[model samples]
Target: MADIRIVDVSLRDGNQSLWGAVGLNSAQIFQIAPVMERVGFCALDFSSSTHMGMAVRTDHEDPWERLRVTHQLMPNTPLQFIGTGLRFISWESQHPEFMQLAYDRLVANGIGRFVVLDPMHDEQAIMETARMFRQAGCKEIIGALVYTVSAVHDDAYYADLAGKMAASPNIDRVYIKDPSGLLTPHRARTLIPAIRARLAGKALELHSHCTIGLAPLTYMDAAELGVDVLQVACGPLANGSSLPSAERVIANLRELGHKVDIDDRALRQVCDYFTRLAKVEGRPAGKPQDYDASFLRHQVAGGVMSTTRRQLSELHLEHRFDEVMAEVTRVRAELGYPIMVTPFPQMVCTQALYNVIGDERYSNVADQLIRYALGRFGRPTTPIDPDVLDRILSRPRAAELMHEAEALPLKEMRKKFSPKLSDEEFILRATMPADQVDAMCKKGASKRHYNPEAAGLVKLLKALGERPRQSRVFIQQPGLTLDIRSAAKEAN
Candidate 1:
């Protein structure tokens, strides 16, 4: 089995990357930690130190409380956390040694490992940061080079940077941080090995984003090149704006004859949880937009279209969707900016096209929107479709209908809704005490958890430390009422 460590950044990177606006709550992190541990992740990038700079409560933003809660819930699993060294701790601050203080607190609170990502301001500062971590008794340091790939440079520059990272005595592991998902798989396959060769005895890691849809392949190539660790995101956090999924990569790698010792079951459970979470958050879930040149540039340049859409919505810009797209086109043209043919632009154009009075020419308009956005248009012309535009414009309550229609299949839907059950009640319902069905629903069984699969019911029951009783029966939908008396009797 090839030695591969799974470091799940769902709580830290995943949350910050996607849910930065709302920030993750302690409740959500508490719900996810055991699932991550159960899935056999080597570490959790629990929370970032960056939260201190942002004005938010620890409960609202910092994941420390959740990490502590998870420790209480699953005491057996070792917890690992991360801190970035990029932001400067204010010298005039109330707490003078903020960085060291944050570092000490995490270590004191059971975080066994740490990752130090340097700021874009300075590269060599990583050496000093690592030394400070070592002085503070930090073990297992991952010396991360952040946003290095975004620099206008050639392959040789990247190779030389890797070599500098390897030669740093303060660092334990050297990681190539694609703060933007710009590294193509072919690039990763070539570059990761070059870095690995430079750091023959030291740990080499790769961190890529799914913004360009190349993260999974990059992970595979990293594995092939003897990379030590690969950062991953679980569930909906796995693509578009998140990292490649650890579960998918491990499965693919194992199939290809290399071994990675991550727990597949845990990964799936975590993914299920996050997918549900994303739906609740009103963001698109699952694998990200397809990779292309435009998307890569967007990610590299720190584009804000995803965030921009939210801002536009808050300002009630839906009525001006077409105008907004026209503005997008105008700005791009004026600055010679590149827009990729990614799903986001398509979605934006769709919204714009939806608002315009559709003529047959509108289809061509949409096509041209895509072509021009991708920098491929020689003479992009507008096309329109009258009926299509009429259907879009005349439709009443279209947004509401669209929102309600985004549900997943029942089988998949059961994962996220926590039946309002008290912890005890959840155990009883999940255990399938047969007679407990009505009581379970009445006691707060979330509507989403009512599965027809007796097997899943049994597994869940077992996970909750309950043994199945004879009342474990598969009830077909819209059929027989659950027999409570008989099931209760069996349970007793």
Candidate 2:
């Protein structure tokens, strides 16, 4: 039996799938860092550009500081990050100098591995990102094949792409990423061997989700076909829409006569801590979900679904979710079925919601959709529907967009913005609004580390210690009653 290695995605994809990527703060991650470091994982899926943006926007935490602190705790382990080929975290493409400087800072802050993907399956863009990673001194660069079901994306199609990725000298590994959890065991039976045949003995890893309850079976099939690494998550963060549980995968592998090198005791400790932390924080724990065939239609990712629901709730349109979802299916096909991953899924869904709620179909198209039709994002795998294309292009903005010039280079951007700012600050300023950056800068670094379980107890004790002279503390439970009053009396 071949030995199988596991990459833990609890910190990155787990939180993304289960809690919308905004559930954990820097303090919470810091409290659990040491326990994660001891779990004997082959590598840790540490952070992503999305996670960094969420930190700055929602938690007011310095993303660079988060990386530096995480690296300090797990100095021996290789930390991995994910990004699109040209864009850092935003949907728009960034300047090449900005991309290079971001990569350099990441490596200097202790990121060792990068998983670069182009959502449009553009080979040149992926290779360019790989080159940038190499130039920035990253130790390992993994090219990603984003899996999706479409007429144009057959096994042969994927095999050809995998072959090209394997031939790239800059890429040390290739990742088959099923972010939507759509890969079934039956599909893996043929797809795995086809890609494996073209890999030329290069390392290949499988990263799938459990949204439809098919990933565990798919993982087994891929392992039988000689996949080198299986990406999984700890128990509290596993199953559901996240990856399969590490403990379950280990047991299944051993039952199948494969060898896995992991410390069971340490894994248990990590699981137990996270389980309690989820409860204390009032967050949902990952659980196995029954298969949902409707997922094949919308194809929204696990993480994107959470954010979508939140968005609908914010707009008071939660009741129209089913209508919006059905519209998404139609919209995806009209736009030529762009793979349901970051940026694309978000772009498609935004346009769909606009159509569903705007009182007239195709009356209000999003700017991103217009940009997509103009080939600003990338070329689509298949041709967009003619009617939809005409409607989008007929808009007056399309003419204005056609006349737009190229984005400014780094040198020009420096002059346009401020030239004195550091690359990190400049990049943030370029991507985010100045008010958001100012708010993040004002908050500064967090001083106190948070342990969810202990935090609740601390709050309760502090509340009990602050009783007024005339006030009495009352406690009543089944078969127990207690009352306490402050000893000091009010002066007349």
Candidate 3:
């Protein structure tokens, strides 16, 4: 088995999730780097070459001066930064040379480890990028398979792919990157072993999101299968868009007879520091309650909820809480409720329940709902009962629910969830008004119902009159606000 490693991707992936969250000064990166290194992370997934251009254009100086400072902060921990094979936005195309320029500049610095992020799942592109990096003298190159899933096949297919990927001479490591947090435990157990079998003499790492709340368990399974490295985010910034917890995973692995040398106490302090920072930054310290199981199902079923409070307010669907609840049930039947894919679904579902049952019983109802969902779905460790639900629903929120019920579409709602048809059928069924579908496609550059195929939708929407909703999906609290240099002095 390859020796285990941990790469703290909080700076790169963590910051990417947070909106306006990446302007941290060098001192900030420096401050966080040691804590991570002390916790036994092998490298820092520093920042993105794609987003770096934003900092570069906005500032007169090099935006990654913070990364240089991070080097000093973590003199020992290697720096592993990201380079993308595809640009996320058309805006990047406006400066077509940014990708190569960014790669050159990042390498010019002391960055030793590079994650060639192939968002399109194009192994050929990754191979070409690997060639370029090898030519650039980057010895430790990681090829990332972003949003990768073997759902279409069984473990054997994934294992075969891993073996083939391991044979690449230029690639040092293969990171199974699941940006959407979709990997399941059963699948992990099956696939990890298969991949290990194929890569018996090669290095393999697993980088996944906890979207389905499976990170902790999945990490354990991967370790058991002899994964070389795992990714993690530090703390409260830890869960939402962050990777699985490193200390927890390492500790769990050690208990299961694996050798890992992580400082648990230091990890705790780092978690505390970021938790406190999140509060100071005006983002809630704890995970948001609105993203419970129901909300996760909504997303999984290709249902998109408006994150803008204004849009939600305009819907005025409060009075129709029961109807929305009915819709939730129907959609669940169609797509499986508590899809249990999102680790934080309970947070969103609780908010949705609050809107349904009102504040009077919101907590109790939410608790019962989540508990029931968990138990029903085989995660019965969390305590929840209907009696407790009854108690918490007796407060002021009950009245709030009654008031909001007036605006809800009690009559127009569908009563049953049906299997999703073809791409055209999904768009026609999921969205209202053909014009709205076109408008949304134009805005998001994605198909109306498909999250992955939204490139065209994102562009079309931008071309038309609508703007894509600000993606707050993977953002952190205590968001980065200033350019790197300004934040450096501010941090000091």
| Number of the predicted model whose lDDT against the real structure is largest | 2
Minimal lDDT window, size 10, model 1: 87-96
Assess candidate 3 and give its lDDT.
Answer: 0.53
The stretch of ten residues in a row with the least summed lDDT in candidate 2 is 483-492
Candidate 3: 10-residue stretch with minimal lDDT: 444-453
- Per-residue error for 3 in candidate 3, Å, reads 5.7
Find the number of clashing residue pairs for candidate 2. Answer: 0
Q: Which stretches of candidate 3 lie over 4 Å from their true place?
A: 1-3, 18-20, 54-61, 86-101, 147-157, 286-492
Query: With candidate 2 superimposed using the best TM-score fit, by how many Å does residue 248's alpha carbon deviate from the native?
Result: 1.3
Q: Which candidate has the top score in TM-score?
A: 2
Candidate 3, residues 130-192, lDDT tens digits: the string is: 776776677698766443332233566556656766788877777777765666677777777
In model 2, what lDDT does residue 277 have?
A: 83
- Output the better candidate (2/3) by TM-score: 2
Ranking by TM-score: 2, 1, 3
Query: TM-scores across all candidates?
Result: 0.58, 0.89, 0.57
Q: After superposition, how far is residue 171 of candidate 2 from its true place, in Å?
A: 0.9
Q: What value does the lDDT take at residue 374 in candidate 2? A: 95
Clashing pairs in 2: none
